[model samples]
Target chain A: MIVIELSERQLKIIEIVKENEPITSEQIAQFLKVTRATLRPDLAILTMSGMLDARPKVGYLYSGNNTVSIISEHVKRTKVSEIKSMPVVVDEQTTLYDALVSLFLEDVGSIYVLSHGYLAGVISRKDFLKNIMGGTDIHKMPVGLIMTRMPNIVTTYPHETALEAAIKIIEHEVDSLPVVEKFEEKGKEYFKVVGKVSKTNITRLFVELGRQK
Target chain B: MIVIELSERQLKIIEIVKENEPITSEQIAQFLKVTRATLRPDLAILTMSGMLDARPKVGYLYSGNNTVSIISEHVKRTKVSEIKSMPVVVDEQTTLYDALVSLFLEDVGSIYVLSHGYLAGVISRKDFLKNIMGGTDIHKMPVGLIMTRMPNIVTTYPHETALEAAIKIIEHEVDSLPVVEKFEEKGKEYFKVVGKVSKTNITRLFVELGRQK
Candidate 1:
């Protein structure tokens, strides 16, 4: 947690130490703008802060400390395979209870809604939760009303890097991105929901990578 | 845990239903090289096995089922941001115990060894475990001998996609790849270890995307 306040003299000292650590005070004072007496106090402070190393003959050296924050350091760059849950989907006309069971049993954050075998809408846990709480008939309602509609869907390539995807998650403020595979059927285009990614998946990755250490 | 044993008739039924799900069994039977009675049995078995859905009159459709494995599915994808740990690392001269402490405390899968401010080698948790079982002096042994050294140390660019890296991991049969950013120091070359990518990260990405459903 040492935040080094750079002074002109300290910066010079840093440069000198950077060149060759274990340098003597006399040589530093003679070559630099500051006096050895003036430099002594700075040296002592830097050394004490663990930012600098001190020696009897050689004056000092930067501790060579370069550290990222603990949380960021342990961050794992996931692959599509790691975060993608197998698809849990239903027709736009399926009963709410059926969708709820799929979401619950799969333990997924969201579910894809298909229409005649086409990517249609995404139904999230929040959507289902809100519906269940609103006293709606579980068997009567279809997911199409509450589901996020198409063209709004965020997706990733089966071959994309997780770090890039992480950036997308942060920037877009979206919790997950579906992994999709394109197929041609009956001479037409269709997007098959193959897998899914969630924020928890990102957290789990760090957990696993962190466990390695 | 139902493994759909495919017969030629069953495969034909699947292909037809897969292309046009919610299409009636009569239609599938018409399209396939089979009779309606034969298709009815396949449809019944598929639905019972959680592979298809049967509506009274609308016909039979693949349920998008059984693709999600309950066992592997729970190992959720997580962001790299949540874990609290320093980057797992050590100098070339550091004893195996020094690396082990970082490994155990952080619970990470791998540790990188640095020398002259450059990555020299990587030691995986598996490596450490195997070595310990082989009766090596963890306290006395320097990791230089056991580490996967330079050139053998596979790397990835920070900008590369997670999907690409995952394929690389499978291709290389390595546990992880150091995310590398290259630069010149004193007109010479060096690589800064920016981050790391592993299988867990890939899995986490999938989880994150799935949750957004």
Candidate 2:
């Protein structure tokens, strides 16, 4: 099980409560311009989470004790280099059949496309799956032809934390991110493939932290 | 940005430091069976996140003041009914092509497979993409033939919080979940599909909660 954080509506309720201390549920409803019944879930969540304490006729009061919440600080201070694992690399010229075999053999969700030891593109399960499902001649097609190329690829650095990595994963809707390091190669900026991070990495952190006191 | 939680390694380090107050970084590295250089990143993370305070000669101290951690409780208290959205449903008899059309038209990642208004299975983009890529006749094939069937399906109750839903999503490696409520149908147990929840919903909650004090 994971921890549930305050929802968007709950945050709004708290903000309103902070501005109007000891506010009644009805008053909060009015501020939000919604019915009292509609706010019941939000109120219940806030109260149960200890962000607000309520009493009959006393109204909702901001408990405000959750100062220094762990996650926010953890995200800010974590650099990408901390949790990244070595990337699964594949050459762009590799045939789709070879790439597919590599993907399953390595049991990795994605493989980074490398050209002469620099990041070039990425191919994932979906990419290969899509091609195979489409009846492409896997043995003849180069993986690079269908790979999501650079500049469009989302990447993170070792100096960034897993939190930033998670956001990129969610935002880009990709299963993994190539953790890269920047360098100037022949007067052109290039990101050298270094490591990778995925949604699993972030979720694992959540589970671990929740287990702590 | 998403809220960052401590990784298992970081948590273990904190536990060690807590048990051995004013412990040196060298002592931590020794206990973890790694060289001091290897532990530098973890130590930097802990210190920067305020979980630890280090002094030149004093070693490390557990600063442990994350009193308002949101996840553990929030996950336990919030129910699936609170965050679920209307499920995208399709009949088992629907052709793969039709189902694929519905999935894209609805702009949803997954579709619930319903047999006579009771959920029988689930089909997702991966499923469709896989089938189409495999050279299957989408027009002739029924979605039910290839869908992940019941009992094997991971589901959640409306009364369960989003935290459980999130964990199920991660553990099962599914993009979304069908929120369900159990009912007795002719002396047999059946789960009535009520709504749906996705990873996006969970991450959105985290972002909103983190933005609050």
TM-score for all predictions? 0.36, 0.63
Best by TM-score: 2
The per-prediction i-RMS, to one decimal, reads 28.1, 12.3
* TM-score of model 1 vs. true structure: 0.36
Error of 2 at B122 (Å): 1.9
Model 2, B1-213: lDDT tens per residue? Answer: 013345687789989999999999899988999988667756765664456899888999988765434344544455678777788898989998788767656767789999888989999776775565466888899999999999888998887766667778877877788888888869987878999987656654554444455
TM-score of chain A, model number 2: 0.68
Question: Residue A183, candidate 1: how far off, in angstroms?
Answer: 4.1
What lDDT score goes with residue B172 in model 1?
A: 74
DockQ of each: 0.01, 0.09
Please provide, for model 2 over A20-101, each residue's C-alpha lDDT reduced to its tens digit, 9 standing for 90 to 100: 9889999999998998877775675466456688978889998885542434465456566776777889898999878866
User: Once model 2 is optimally superposed onto the true structure by TM-score, how far is the C-alpha of residue A47 displaced, in angstroms?
Assistant: 19
